[model samples]
Target: MLAVLIPLVLLMSGLSAGVLLGTQLGGFPLLAALPTDRYVHAHAFFATRYDPFMPICFVGTVVGDIALAVLAPEAAASGFYIVGAVLALATVTISLVKNVPTNKWVQTLDPENLPEGPDYEGKRADWGRWNRNRSYLAVAALVANCAALAALAVLI
Candidate 1:
Protein backbone atom coordinates (compact mmCIF):
# COMPACT_ATOMS: atom_id res chain seq x y z
CA MET A 1 0.00 0.00 0.00
CA LEU A 2 2.75 2.41 0.93
CA ALA A 3 4.50 1.56 -2.30
CA VAL A 4 1.53 2.62 -4.38
CA LEU A 5 0.52 5.57 -2.24
CA ILE A 6 3.92 7.22 -1.98
CA PRO A 7 4.26 7.71 -5.71
CA LEU A 8 0.67 8.83 -6.12
CA VAL A 9 1.07 11.48 -3.43
CA LEU A 10 4.28 12.71 -5.01
CA LEU A 11 2.69 13.02 -8.44
CA MET A 12 -0.28 15.03 -7.17
CA SER A 13 1.90 17.30 -5.04
CA GLY A 14 4.31 17.89 -7.91
CA LEU A 15 1.53 18.82 -10.31
CA SER A 16 -0.08 21.16 -7.79
CA ALA A 17 3.20 22.82 -6.94
CA GLY A 18 4.20 23.32 -10.56
CA VAL A 19 0.89 24.88 -11.60
CA LEU A 20 0.82 27.19 -8.62
CA LEU A 21 4.40 28.23 -9.26
CA GLY A 22 3.60 29.00 -12.88
CA THR A 23 0.57 31.01 -11.89
CA GLN A 24 2.57 32.97 -9.35
CA LEU A 25 5.40 33.64 -11.76
CA GLY A 26 3.52 34.20 -15.01
CA GLY A 27 -0.26 34.37 -14.76
CA PHE A 28 -0.61 36.69 -11.77
CA PRO A 29 1.86 39.24 -13.06
CA LEU A 30 0.34 39.22 -16.52
CA LEU A 31 -3.12 39.75 -15.14
CA ALA A 32 -1.90 42.39 -12.73
CA ALA A 33 -0.51 44.42 -15.60
CA LEU A 34 -3.75 44.49 -17.55
CA PRO A 35 -6.33 47.26 -17.46
CA THR A 36 -9.25 46.64 -15.14
CA ASP A 37 -11.61 45.46 -17.84
CA ARG A 38 -9.02 43.26 -19.47
CA TYR A 39 -7.98 41.93 -16.12
CA VAL A 40 -11.55 41.11 -15.29
CA HIS A 41 -12.07 39.12 -18.46
CA ALA A 42 -8.68 37.44 -18.37
CA HIS A 43 -8.96 36.57 -14.73
CA ALA A 44 -12.36 35.03 -15.30
CA PHE A 45 -11.02 32.98 -18.17
CA PHE A 46 -7.96 31.76 -16.28
CA ALA A 47 -9.93 31.09 -13.13
CA THR A 48 -12.50 28.92 -14.86
CA ARG A 49 -9.88 26.58 -16.27
CA TYR A 50 -8.24 25.45 -13.00
CA ASP A 51 -11.34 24.30 -11.23
CA PRO A 52 -11.88 20.57 -10.57
CA PHE A 53 -8.31 19.81 -11.66
CA MET A 54 -6.52 21.63 -8.86
CA PRO A 55 -8.97 20.59 -6.19
CA ILE A 56 -8.61 16.99 -7.19
CA CYS A 57 -4.84 17.19 -7.17
CA PHE A 58 -4.78 18.86 -3.78
CA VAL A 59 -7.34 16.60 -2.11
CA GLY A 60 -5.79 13.54 -3.70
CA THR A 61 -2.45 14.47 -2.25
CA VAL A 62 -3.90 14.91 1.18
CA VAL A 63 -5.64 11.56 1.03
CA GLY A 64 -2.55 9.82 -0.25
CA ASP A 65 -0.40 11.32 2.45
CA ILE A 66 -2.82 10.33 5.17
CA ALA A 67 -3.05 6.82 3.80
CA LEU A 68 0.72 6.52 3.73
CA ALA A 69 1.00 7.76 7.26
CA VAL A 70 -1.57 5.33 8.54
CA LEU A 71 -0.34 2.36 6.56
CA ALA A 72 3.26 2.73 7.58
CA PRO A 73 3.22 4.29 10.98
CA GLU A 74 6.22 2.27 12.05
CA ALA A 75 8.33 3.60 9.23
CA ALA A 76 10.41 6.75 9.56
CA ALA A 77 8.58 8.11 6.53
CA SER A 78 5.33 8.48 8.43
CA GLY A 79 6.44 11.72 10.06
CA PHE A 80 7.09 13.30 6.73
CA TYR A 81 3.78 12.07 5.41
CA ILE A 82 1.95 13.67 8.29
CA VAL A 83 3.72 16.96 7.67
CA GLY A 84 2.99 16.78 4.00
CA ALA A 85 -0.68 16.09 4.65
CA VAL A 86 -0.95 19.10 6.95
CA LEU A 87 0.65 21.40 4.41
CA ALA A 88 -1.55 20.14 1.61
CA LEU A 89 -4.62 20.57 3.80
CA ALA A 90 -3.58 24.14 4.52
CA THR A 91 -3.46 24.86 0.81
CA VAL A 92 -7.02 23.54 0.46
CA THR A 93 -8.24 25.51 3.44
CA ILE A 94 -6.84 28.76 2.09
CA SER A 95 -8.30 28.10 -1.32
CA LEU A 96 -11.75 27.52 0.14
CA VAL A 97 -11.73 30.37 2.63
CA LYS A 98 -9.92 33.04 0.63
CA ASN A 99 -9.31 32.43 -3.05
CA VAL A 100 -12.51 30.65 -4.10
CA PRO A 101 -14.89 33.38 -3.03
CA THR A 102 -12.86 35.98 -4.87
CA ASN A 103 -12.87 33.74 -7.93
CA LYS A 104 -16.64 33.34 -7.75
CA TRP A 105 -17.08 37.09 -7.46
CA VAL A 106 -14.78 37.77 -10.42
CA GLN A 107 -16.66 35.29 -12.54
CA THR A 108 -19.91 37.22 -11.99
CA LEU A 109 -18.50 40.64 -12.88
CA ASP A 110 -19.18 42.56 -16.06
CA PRO A 111 -15.87 43.40 -17.67
CA GLU A 112 -17.26 46.63 -19.07
CA ASN A 113 -18.38 47.92 -15.72
CA LEU A 114 -16.45 46.58 -12.78
CA PRO A 115 -17.13 47.45 -9.16
CA GLU A 116 -17.79 51.15 -8.43
CA GLY A 117 -14.58 51.74 -6.48
CA PRO A 118 -11.13 50.36 -5.48
CA ASP A 119 -12.66 47.14 -4.17
CA TYR A 120 -11.83 45.36 -7.39
CA GLU A 121 -8.14 46.02 -7.16
CA GLY A 122 -8.09 45.16 -3.49
CA LYS A 123 -9.91 41.91 -4.08
CA ARG A 124 -7.63 40.99 -6.95
CA ALA A 125 -4.53 41.70 -4.88
CA ASP A 126 -5.93 39.65 -2.04
CA TRP A 127 -6.62 36.77 -4.38
CA GLY A 128 -3.08 36.92 -5.72
CA ARG A 129 -1.61 36.99 -2.24
CA TRP A 130 -3.77 34.10 -1.10
CA ASN A 131 -2.79 32.12 -4.16
CA ARG A 132 0.85 32.87 -3.54
CA ASN A 133 0.49 31.66 0.01
CA ARG A 134 -1.21 28.49 -1.23
CA SER A 135 1.62 28.04 -3.72
CA TYR A 136 4.16 28.25 -0.93
CA LEU A 137 2.23 25.67 1.09
CA ALA A 138 2.06 23.35 -1.88
CA VAL A 139 5.77 23.64 -2.55
CA ALA A 140 6.46 22.92 1.07
CA ALA A 141 4.22 19.88 0.89
CA LEU A 142 6.08 18.66 -2.17
CA VAL A 143 9.36 18.98 -0.31
CA ALA A 144 7.91 17.00 2.55
CA ASN A 145 6.65 14.36 0.15
CA CYS A 146 10.11 14.10 -1.37
CA ALA A 147 11.61 13.76 2.05
CA ALA A 148 9.12 10.98 2.80
CA LEU A 149 10.22 9.10 -0.29
CA ALA A 150 13.82 9.42 0.77
CA ALA A 151 13.05 8.17 4.22
CA LEU A 152 11.17 5.23 2.80
CA ALA A 153 14.11 4.44 0.57
CA VAL A 154 16.44 4.32 3.53
CA LEU A 155 14.02 2.42 5.71
CA ILE A 156 13.15 -0.17 3.11
Candidate 2:
Protein backbone atom coordinates (compact mmCIF):
# COMPACT_ATOMS: atom_id res chain seq x y z
CA MET A 1 0.00 0.00 0.00
CA LEU A 2 2.78 2.38 0.92
CA ALA A 3 4.62 1.52 -2.27
CA VAL A 4 1.63 2.42 -4.41
CA LEU A 5 0.12 5.32 -2.48
CA ILE A 6 3.40 7.09 -2.02
CA PRO A 7 4.30 7.37 -5.66
CA LEU A 8 0.80 8.09 -6.82
CA VAL A 9 0.33 10.92 -4.34
CA LEU A 10 3.64 12.45 -5.16
CA LEU A 11 3.03 12.17 -8.87
CA MET A 12 -0.46 13.64 -8.75
CA SER A 13 0.73 16.48 -6.58
CA GLY A 14 3.77 17.25 -8.65
CA LEU A 15 2.05 17.07 -11.99
CA SER A 16 -0.93 19.09 -10.82
CA ALA A 17 1.22 21.90 -9.54
CA GLY A 18 3.60 21.69 -12.47
CA VAL A 19 0.86 22.15 -14.99
CA LEU A 20 -0.56 25.03 -13.03
CA LEU A 21 2.81 26.65 -13.10
CA GLY A 22 3.06 26.11 -16.81
CA THR A 23 -0.24 27.84 -17.35
CA GLN A 24 0.77 30.74 -15.14
CA LEU A 25 4.11 31.11 -16.84
CA GLY A 26 3.43 30.03 -20.39
CA GLY A 27 -0.19 29.69 -21.47
CA PHE A 28 -1.44 32.81 -19.70
CA PRO A 29 1.30 34.97 -21.16
CA LEU A 30 0.72 33.71 -24.68
CA LEU A 31 -2.98 34.26 -24.41
CA ALA A 32 -2.48 37.73 -22.98
CA ALA A 33 -0.14 38.62 -25.80
CA LEU A 34 -2.69 37.74 -28.46
CA PRO A 35 -5.12 40.31 -29.78
CA THR A 36 -8.51 40.00 -28.10
CA ASP A 37 -10.72 40.68 -31.14
CA ARG A 38 -10.00 37.67 -33.39
CA TYR A 39 -6.34 36.71 -33.29
CA VAL A 40 -6.97 35.01 -29.97
CA HIS A 41 -9.58 32.86 -31.62
CA ALA A 42 -7.23 31.67 -34.32
CA HIS A 43 -4.35 31.17 -31.91
CA ALA A 44 -6.47 29.25 -29.47
CA PHE A 45 -7.88 27.17 -32.30
CA PHE A 46 -4.45 26.21 -33.57
CA ALA A 47 -3.21 25.67 -30.04
CA THR A 48 -5.98 23.22 -29.29
CA ARG A 49 -4.97 21.37 -32.41
CA TYR A 50 -1.21 21.35 -31.71
CA ASP A 51 -0.84 21.37 -27.93
CA PRO A 52 -0.16 18.05 -26.19
CA PHE A 53 0.44 19.05 -22.58
CA MET A 54 -3.19 19.74 -21.63
CA PRO A 55 -4.32 16.32 -22.79
CA ILE A 56 -1.49 14.58 -20.97
CA CYS A 57 -2.04 16.51 -17.76
CA PHE A 58 -5.77 15.99 -17.88
CA VAL A 59 -5.41 12.24 -18.26
CA GLY A 60 -2.74 12.08 -15.62
CA THR A 61 -4.79 14.00 -13.05
CA VAL A 62 -7.92 11.91 -13.63
CA VAL A 63 -6.08 8.60 -13.59
CA GLY A 64 -3.92 9.43 -10.63
CA ASP A 65 -6.92 10.65 -8.67
CA ILE A 66 -8.90 7.48 -9.32
CA ALA A 67 -5.90 5.39 -8.46
CA LEU A 68 -5.39 7.26 -5.21
CA ALA A 69 -8.98 6.74 -4.25
CA VAL A 70 -8.73 3.02 -4.82
CA LEU A 71 -5.27 2.37 -3.44
CA ALA A 72 -5.30 4.68 -0.45
CA PRO A 73 -8.58 4.38 1.31
CA GLU A 74 -7.11 5.84 4.45
CA ALA A 75 -6.24 8.92 2.52
CA ALA A 76 -9.25 8.90 0.25
CA ALA A 77 -11.78 8.20 2.97
CA SER A 78 -11.65 11.68 4.48
CA GLY A 79 -10.24 15.17 5.03
CA PHE A 80 -7.54 16.72 2.85
CA TYR A 81 -7.24 13.83 0.45
CA ILE A 82 -10.92 13.84 -0.23
CA VAL A 83 -10.88 17.60 -0.71
CA GLY A 84 -7.90 17.24 -2.98
CA ALA A 85 -9.53 14.52 -5.03
CA VAL A 86 -12.81 16.35 -5.23
CA LEU A 87 -11.08 19.53 -6.29
CA ALA A 88 -9.04 17.61 -8.81
CA LEU A 89 -12.19 16.09 -10.23
CA ALA A 90 -13.85 19.50 -10.27
CA THR A 91 -10.88 20.89 -12.13
CA VAL A 92 -11.31 18.35 -14.89
CA THR A 93 -15.06 18.69 -14.89
CA ILE A 94 -14.80 22.45 -15.39
CA SER A 95 -12.34 22.00 -18.24
CA LEU A 96 -14.66 19.58 -19.98
CA VAL A 97 -17.90 21.42 -19.29
CA LYS A 98 -16.60 24.92 -19.76
CA ASN A 99 -13.12 25.51 -21.13
CA VAL A 100 -13.01 23.01 -23.99
CA PRO A 101 -16.32 24.14 -25.36
CA THR A 102 -15.22 27.74 -25.04
CA ASN A 103 -12.05 26.97 -26.96
CA LYS A 104 -13.98 25.18 -29.67
CA TRP A 105 -16.38 28.06 -29.97
CA VAL A 106 -13.51 30.47 -30.25
CA GLN A 107 -11.79 28.29 -32.81
CA THR A 108 -14.74 28.31 -35.18
CA LEU A 109 -14.62 32.09 -35.40
CA ASP A 110 -12.65 33.46 -38.28
CA PRO A 111 -9.59 35.41 -37.12
CA GLU A 112 -10.69 38.37 -39.17
CA ASN A 113 -14.38 37.68 -39.50
CA LEU A 114 -15.71 36.60 -36.14
CA PRO A 115 -19.39 37.37 -35.63
CA GLU A 116 -20.37 40.29 -33.47
CA GLY A 117 -22.63 38.15 -31.32
CA PRO A 118 -19.94 36.42 -29.29
CA ASP A 119 -18.23 38.74 -26.87
CA TYR A 120 -14.56 37.84 -27.27
CA GLU A 121 -13.37 40.07 -24.41
CA GLY A 122 -16.01 38.75 -22.09
CA LYS A 123 -15.11 35.21 -22.98
CA ARG A 124 -11.46 35.95 -22.33
CA ALA A 125 -12.27 37.46 -18.95
CA ASP A 126 -14.42 34.51 -17.95
CA TRP A 127 -11.77 32.06 -19.09
CA GLY A 128 -9.14 33.91 -17.13
CA ARG A 129 -11.23 33.81 -13.96
CA TRP A 130 -11.92 30.09 -14.28
CA ASN A 131 -8.32 29.30 -15.11
CA ARG A 132 -7.18 31.10 -11.97
CA ASN A 133 -9.68 29.18 -9.91
CA ARG A 134 -8.44 25.96 -11.46
CA SER A 135 -4.90 26.88 -10.54
CA TYR A 136 -5.98 27.36 -6.95
CA LEU A 137 -7.55 23.92 -7.03
CA ALA A 138 -4.34 22.44 -8.33
CA VAL A 139 -2.36 24.11 -5.58
CA ALA A 140 -4.78 22.89 -2.95
CA ALA A 141 -4.58 19.39 -4.37
CA LEU A 142 -0.82 19.45 -4.23
CA VAL A 143 -0.88 20.52 -0.60
CA ALA A 144 -3.46 17.95 0.33
CA ASN A 145 -1.59 15.19 -1.47
CA CYS A 146 1.55 16.10 0.41
CA ALA A 147 -0.32 16.12 3.70
CA ALA A 148 -1.77 12.69 2.99
CA LEU A 149 1.61 11.37 2.01
CA ALA A 150 3.09 12.72 5.18
CA ALA A 151 0.39 11.16 7.25
CA LEU A 152 0.87 7.83 5.53
CA ALA A 153 4.58 8.06 6.09
CA VAL A 154 4.14 8.74 9.81
CA LEU A 155 1.95 5.69 10.21
CA ILE A 156 4.28 3.43 8.27
Best by lDDT: 1
Provide the global lDDT of candidate 2 against the true structure. 0.67
Per-candidate clashes, comma-separated: 0, 0
**lDDT tens readout by residue for model 1, 22-92:** 99999999999998899989999999898799999999999999988888655667899999999999999
- Evaluate model 1: give its lDDT: 0.91
The residue ranges of model 2 lying beyond 4 angstroms of the native Cα positions read: 45-63, 66-78
Q: List where candidate 1 sits over 4 angstroms from the true fold.
A: none
- Which number leads on TM-score? 1
Give TM-scores for every candidate, taking all chains together and pairing residue i with residue i.
0.95, 0.77
Model 2 misses residue 101 by how many Å?
A: 1.2
Clashing residue pairs in candidate 2 (N, C-alpha, C atoms within 3 angstroms): none
lDDT of 1 at 55: 97
